[model samples]
Target: WDFLESPGTDEVLYGGAKYGGKSWFLCVWSYLRACAFAKKHKIPKSSHPLKVGFLGRKVAKMFRETTLDTWFKTIPADGYVAKGNPTEIIIDDRVKILTGGFDNRELVNKFNSAEFAFFAVDQAEELTRDEMALLRLATFGRLVVNEKAIPGKGLLTANPRHCWLKDEFILNPIKQRKFVSALPTDNPYCTQKYIDNLIDSLKHRPKLLAAYRYGNWDVLEDAEQVIMDSWLESALNRHGEYWPFVKEYIAIDCARFGDDETVILLMNNTDIKEKIVMPYCRTTEISGRAAALSHQNNDCELVVESIGSDLGAGVVDELTELGHSVLVYTPQGKSSEPDKYYNCRAEAWSKTAKVLCSGVIDEDSNCFVALTKRGEGDNYGLDDTMRGQLCTPHYKWVRGKIVIEPKEDIKDKLGRSPDHADAYVIAVWAWPFISMPNKSGSVRHRKRQKSPMSM
Candidate 1:
C-alpha cells in the first residue's frame, strides 16, 4: 500500500522467499492503476485505445501460465476484455494493458518502440541487467493519459537470488528506487500447510532453504561451494608452525580486463610467504613480469602463469627467454584426471580445498598456511579478499564428473575477477614437492600423492 501511495518513487521492488503475495500484488496493483488512470481521463467516442501499462515475465509461455492466470483470477469481468495478437487486457473501453516476455527479442523489440504509463515484471531475477535497462528506457518521457503526461512508474517482484537485483535493490539502491521486503508470512492469506510443505522439501538443502524459505540474498548458490568460510578461518595465521621446505613455487594471474588486478603469490612448500596485487595500467604487463622475476629464488622449482589475455602470454614468453622454466595454466584446458574433473580449473580448486583442510605436505604433518599482518587496521591484505572470492565459486556434478561454475558467473557475483584465489590454486596444483633428507643423510624420492582419490 505504501508503494501505491508514494508518487515520488519512480521504481520499487517487492521481493522475498516463496509463497509471498508477489504475483498477486503486482498483477492486481497494475490492473487497478491502469483502470484508475483510464477513469480519470475519459476519451472521445471514436478515439484509439491508449497503452496504459505493461506486465512481463522471463518467458512468454511461462507468463501466460503463471502471472496471466493470477491477473485473470483477481480482475472484474464486466468492463475489461482480453484481445490483441499476443493477448492484452482492454479496460474501460479505451485503456490497454500489454504483456511481453523479457527473453523474447521480437516482443521486446515491439514493446521497446511503444510507450506506457507504468511497467511491472514478475520473477524479475531471471532477467539480465541489460534487459532491465531496456525495460526502463521504454518509459522515459513517454507516460501519457488522454494526451496529458504523468510520472512513469515501475515495479518488480522476485525471489532471493544472487544477481544484479540483490546489488541494486538490497545492497545499494538509488534515491528514486524503494525496496519493500515481502515474505510468505507477510501475506495473511498464505496457508500454514504450504509453508510446512516448503520446509519439508528443502530440509536437506540448507543453502536453498535459507534462500527460498528465509530470503537470504547472501547465500550465493545451491551448488556445493569450493571453499567454506570455516576452512579459511581455521587456516589463518598458520605460517608460524615449523615445516621442512626444499621447493619454491610462484604463481601469477594476469589482469584480463580494464578493472581487474594482476595477482602474484610466492609459496615455499605449503606456506604462502607473500602476495601482491597491482591495478591494471599501461605498465602493468612490464611491472608484472618484473614482479614475477623479483620473487624467484635459487630453490624455485617451477613457475606457473594463468593467462587470459595477451599481456599474460607476453610475460610467459619473456620469462622463457630468461632461462626460467614457465608453464602455461589454461583454465579451460583438459584436466590431468579427465575421468574425475571437467577442467583444469576445477581440479586445481578441489586440490586446494584438501590442502586447506588437512593434507600432508611431504613428511611434515602441516597443511597450507598463510601469514597475517601483526597490526590492526586492514591487516588481512589480499587474503581477506581471496577468502570472500574463494567462497563464491560453486561446483556441480555433470555426467559423473565435477564441473566448476564459469568464470563470468563468478565475476558477476563478486563484481570482479577472483584473481587472488586463482593464483593461490595454481601454486597448490603445480607445486613440485621433493622429499626432505632423512636422519642418516640419505635422500628418498617418491611421487607426491595425498591419496589415490586425493590431490
Candidate 2:
C-alpha cells in the first residue's frame, strides 16, 4: 500500500525475500498504474502509447520464464497482448510495457532511447548501480499524467546481497526512497509445504535462512565464507579512526594480460593510502612502477605474491635489482603452524580474516587489528569488488587442517580472479613479518604519488 499510495517517493523497494509476491506486486502495480493513466487521460487507441514502462531482470530469458510468466498469469487476458521477439505487452490500447534484461545488449540499447512513465525491476540485485541509475534516468520528466509531468516513480524487488541496493536502501536511504520488507510469511498464498521445504533446505545454513526466510540483511554470509559481512562492515566503519604507525608497505597482485586485473595497495601499518589498478600491463612494467612508488613513499617494503607463477618472482628480482627491499609471498609454502593449516596461503587468509574481525569478534582480546583507508577524506577505502572478492571464497578442512579453496575455483565463481582480495591478504600477511625501523619516527607526509598508468 505504501508503494502504490505514496506518490512522494520517486523510488520504492517492495520485497527482500522469495515467495513475497514481489514479481506479482511489481507487475500488477505497474499495469494498474498504466491502466489508470489510460483511463484518466482517455488516450486514443493508437499503435504508439507515447511512453513506455519497463519491467525486467538480469537476463531476458529468465525474466520471460519466471517474472513474465507471473505477469501473464496474474493480469487480465482481455485487450492485453505480448508481441515481438523478446516481448512487449500492450494493454488497453494506451499502456505499453517493454520487458528486457541487462544481459541483452540490444534491448538495453533500445531502452537508452526510450522514455518511461513507470518502470520496475524484479530481482534488481543482479543489476549494478550504474544500470539502476540508467533505469531511473529513463523515467525522469517522462511520467506524464493529464499532460503534466509527475515525479518518476518505480519499484525494485530483490533478495539480500552485499550489493549497492543493500547499501543504498537498507543501510542509508535518501528521502525520496522507501524500502518495504516482504517475507515469505507475509504472503497468504504461499503454501505451507513450500515454506517447510525452504526451512528444511536452509536449516543447516542459519545465515541463508536469516536472509531468505526472515529477510535479515545484517547476516548475508554462509558458514564457509572466510570474511563475514559483519567483519567487513566493522573494518569499513573503522575508516578515519586514529591509530599510530611507522612502518609502510606495498602489496601487489600482478597480471600481465587478458581479463585479469593487477592491483597494488599502498599502506602504512593496516591503513591503506592508495589502491592502484591496471590492466594489460607487463609484470616488469608494473613492478618497476611500484618500486618507484615505494621509493617515493620513503622506501616502504614491497611485498609481492609468487605462488603458482614465476611472475611474482621476476617482480621480486626486478625490485631487488632496483635497490629496494622486497618480500616474496609464496602462499604454497609450509605454514608456521604445520598442523593448523594445509599451507601458508590458508593461514594468511585466516589471519587476515581474523584481523578484519578483530574488535568485533574478539576471539583474541590482545590481537587488535584494523584494516582501514587512511585519513578522514575517503569514507570507504576498500572498493566493492575488493570486499566482495574477500568474502567470496569458502574454506574446507583437509586432513584436520584448514584449507582455502583454490584460486581457480574462486575465479570461476567470481567470473574473474580475486585479485584485489588476494593483494589485501598478501599485505596483511606481510605486516608482522617486516621489522623495519621508523626513519622519521612518524608517518611523514609526501604529496600522494600516482603512477602514470594509475593517473
Candidate 3:
C-alpha cells in the first residue's frame, strides 16, 4: 500500500500503539522514494545514488536496538546492505540511508546541504519543539519526486506524548489534512493472539497498555497526576486543612530557585491519622537562607533537603535557629544504585499512587476531588509528579534508596533545573513521617475482635 499517495504538499502523521505499521510504512516510503528517484533521474544502475537521512531522539541507540533494528530486518536483503558501524544502510547502489539519533546537531545539519527526495523522522514525538522546527526548515524546497515538482515534505511517526505538537501539529484546525489513528487492529501483520495478549497485559498494567497497546492519548492525559489546575487546587487546599490543635507538625521542603516551583509540604501526624496541613508550591525569589527560614516550625522538625544540584548550606543555620531538626540530603552520587532510588520513590509514591491509580484518592480527598473535577478526566495533576520524578532519568532504584545523578550535558541542553522532580524525591523521602501511625490500642482491639470472629 502506498502510504504517501500525495507527498510534499501535506504533512502526514502516522501515530498509534506499538507494532502498528507506522515504522514499517516509513521504511517502505523511504525505500520506494529512493528507487523512484533513481529511476526518474535516468541514472545508470550504479551511477546515481539517492541519499536519505533518518533522525531519532538523543537516545537513538535504544531506538536502533529496538524499532530501527526491526526496520532493518524488514527491508529485503537484495535491495539493502547494513553497514557494520551503525544503523546506516546502503540501498540499491544508487541510494544511501543515513541513520542518526537527535543528539548530534551536526549530523542533522548534514542533511541541510544534501538534496534528498525523502526525509523521515522515525519517532517524531521524541524531538523537542525547537528540533522539530529545525527539521521542518531543513526540508523546505528540497523534495522532488518524479517529473512533478513537489515541495519538501516529511513524515512523522510517533505515539503521542505530552507535547505542543499534539495541539499545534496534529489537532491544528488550520491544517486541512486527515489525522489517521492506526491501531494494532489496522495492521494485518499483528495477530489476534498478540492482540489478546496485549489486552491481557493492559488489564494488569494500564499505563503501558494504554500508551503502547491501545494508542490512546486520553490514557496519557488522564493517567497523569499533576495537571496544572489540579496542582493549584492541591496547593490551595493546604490552607483549608489548618486545625487549631494541629501543633508539632512536620514540613518537608522541596526548594527551587527559578522556573521550578518550590514545594513545601506540611503534615500533622497523630497516632490515628495524618493530615496534610498545607502544600504550597510557588516560584519564590527567596535566597536559600530565606526559603529555609520561611517554612520553619518551633515545635516540629524540618526535612530540608537538596536534589539535582546543591543550592548551598545557608539553610542549615536558619533552620537550626528555629528549634527544628534539619536534615539535608543531596541526591547527586546517590543514583548510581538504581535499585535503591527506584524502591525509595516507589515506596513513597505507592502510598499516593494507590489512591491516584485506583481513583480512590479522588473519593476521600477534597483536594484531589476538586482537582479531578476541574481536570474533566485528565490527570495532569498526577502526571506532573509522575513525569517529573518517574520520567526523569536517574530515578531508577537499585535496592531501596532514591538516587539522583546529574547529567550535565542534558542540563546544559535543556537549560532548566530538574528541581521540580528533585522536590518530589524529597517528598517521597519524607513520606514515612508524613502519615500518622495507627493507635496501638485500636490495633490490639481489632486483633482481639478478629480472634473472636475467627473462633
> lDDT winner among the candidates?
2
Instruction: Please provide, for model 3 over 337-430, each residue's C-alpha lDDT reduced to its tens digit, 9 standing for 90 to 100.
Output: 2432333334333333332333223233222211111122331233344244434342211111322333443355446554444444454445
* lDDT comparing candidate 2 with the true structure: 0.74
Residue 308 of model 1, lDDT score: 52
Q: How do these models rank on lDDT, best leading?
A: 2, 1, 3
Worst 10 residues of 2 by lDDT: 359-368
Instruction: Indicate whether candidate 1 or candidate 3 has the larger TM-score.
Output: 3
Model 2 residue-pair collision total: 0
Candidate ordering by TM-score (highest first): 3, 2, 1
Q: TM-score of each candidate?
A: 0.50, 0.51, 0.52
TM-score of 1: 0.50
- Summarize candidate 1's per-residue lDDT along 86-179 as a digit string, tens digits: 7788876678888868767777887668787788999898789998888787775676664677678899988777789988988998877888
Clashes of 1: 0
Deviation from native of the Cα of residue 255 in model 1, angstroms: 40
**lDDT for predicted candidate 3 compared with the true structure:** 0.48
